[model samples]
Target: MRHFLYICLFISITINSQESIDATLIDSSNLNADQIIDIDNFETLYFIKDHTIYKNHSNKKSINYSNYQLGEITTANVFNPLKINLFYKDFNTVVILDNRLAEIFKIDFNTIQPYKNITQVSTGFDNTLWIFNIDFQQLELYDYKTNTTRFSAVPVQSDVLDLESDYNYCWLLTKNYLYQYNYFGSMISKIENTGFTEISKSNGHLILKKDNILYFKHKKKEEIQPVNLPKLLINQFLLTNETLYIYDLEKLHKYQLKIK
Candidate 1:
């Protein structure tokens, strides 16, 4: 009887451990773009086509921004819709765009004092930018208004694969680990990388992708749970607070994350 009870308990634990979160297909639409950059809270679509950034709104006419001289746009950050950040790595420049895709300001790292080779840039609070200074191998919160760095994190030895931030926290995904830092430049959490290629943040939770599979890491949980999604060819993906958007070259599918 003792052995039989132990066998039943083991089976119950295995069954519970194998259960995964479900993602229901809420909506889908045809998407034709070279890449899907982001979908804002207002349902505005931002994408890239032929080296140009395009913004498509439901109620407004589409507008695009392009600079052939900049070579190529390395990244487009729509964290602040009013102040979109376009990073041109080849020229070491950042172009700030308004809501209508109009260039409002430009920052050329080449012309800045104490030269910074910025490989990545994201929106920071109150007219600031979170930039990765390759020269120092550090992540610096730069005050573009004052032309100075407010604070910087410790040097990261590995190559940074992705950088995403909100108003209060910054997350960096390196080749070996994923790190989260607070606004005061203090390390919050560090999780060893397990082949994660991309990351997106929403409401303090982390959504990570390894190849084509998606994983979710809650701010309060240490375990990274796999998001059970229907089989689809994932070319690009975006994670919002409640929805997971996946693009498969021809169509964009929206899945509602049903976390229990």
Candidate 2:
């Protein structure tokens, strides 16, 4: 009777663990791009090809923006599709594009007063930008309209690996830790590093990737839980709402993330 009880307990534990998270394959389509940037709530696809940023509309024509002089685009922030931010690290410049992929404003950091060696940038609140000034080792909320620094946090100790932000909060991923800051430049939370290479935020939750495995961390939870997903080559991924889009170089797989 003791052996039978142990066997039943083990099966129950296994079943519970496997049902923690469910990934239902919703769609899989062939993708032809060098890198998948993001998919908006409207299901519009944004990608890069030959160093140009392309926006694919569902029922309309596709538009793109490219600056051959900038060498290559380091990253793009499409948080506000109306105002897309493109960072060109090599040139230390950022180009703002309209929804139609038309160049609207260009910021050349080299010519700005009190030069800032900005290594990373993301969209901030109205007429503002979140920038990492390498010289001061600080994350600064820059007011582009006024050409002034609205808020600058204390210097960070480690190199910033990635920087992402919503309108009210900014998440900075460094070599040693991940830090979250509010608009007032207050450090909200500091999470220890655990080989996390990439991060994406959706509705206050963070989806982190370490190696090829993905983990989900809630804003109110301390424990970082691994998301059980079927084995696949994950080259890049984007989290929008409850959908997880993974690009495996040749194809894009869309999965609906459900918690049991």
Candidate 3:
């Protein structure tokens, strides 16, 4: 009887653990989106299709911009809906575009005095930019207007895997650690890397992915929760307070989060 009861308990525990990750697919759409960007207080979805950048509003209207001369876009920032920054690593250039996807200004890092190789770039407060100079292995705040380095941190110890920033803070992820810095290039905080490959941040929440599985860590929560992914072959994903969007192949899946 004791052995039988132990077996029953083990089975119950396993079943409960599996059921804890319950999720429902709300809807899906067919779109060849390589990357997606959602704006605040809007129904528009901006994404990359082929070598061109597209802005889709309510799935009713679409806008696009492409430049073959710029080569492939390394990354894009829609931090400020009014101004967009697109980076091309191979050319060492950054192009600033208006809301309509029209080019406003372009910066070629190769021409900058005291030459530096910029591996990552992000928007900063007051018309500034947060950039990681690969040659110096340092984080720099650059004022585009004056073409000056406002501030810079000492060389980081590890190779930065990813860089993210908002108006006030910049987050740097290395192989072994994640460091946060202020606009003045002061180290605000650092956390040990938990072996996650991709990261997304929005409104103070952090989401990470590894092996196609996502982990969500809320700002106040002490633990990270594993997102119940629909499948294990996700191409890319985005998370908001209420929804999780996953892209696999040419389909986009939306899952409504039931977080407490």
Query: In model 3, which residue pairs have backbone atoms overlapping below 3 Å?
Result: none
lDDT of each: 0.89, 0.89, 0.78
Could you tell me the TM-score of candidate 1? 0.92
Q: Which stretches of candidate 1 lie over 4 Å from their true place?
A: 1-17
**True-structure RMSD for candidate 1:** 2.2
Summarize candidate 1's per-residue lDDT along 140-207 as a digit string, tens digits.
Answer: 99988789999988899999999999898999999999999888889999989989988988878888
Residue 157, model 2: Cα distance from true site in angstroms? 1.0
Least accurate stretch of 10 residues (summed lDDT) in model 2? 14-23
RMSD after CA superposition, every candidate: 2.2, 3.7, 4.7
For this target, which candidate reaches the highest TM-score against the unseen true structure? 1
Question: For candidate 2, lDDT tens digit of each residue in 35-137?
Answer: 8888988899999999999999779899899999998899999999888999999999999999999988888999999898899999998888999999999
Output the better candidate (1/3) by lDDT: 1
Each candidate's TM vs. the true structure?
Answer: 0.92, 0.91, 0.85
| Per-residue lDDT of 133 in model 1 | 93
Cα lDDT of model 3 by residue, 1-260, tens digit: 99999999999987754543335689888877677765344646778767788988875668888888978888888878777888889999988888899988888889988787999988888778889998888989988878999998978898788877777678888877777787778897778877877777776666777677887766555456677765546777776556777778788787776666
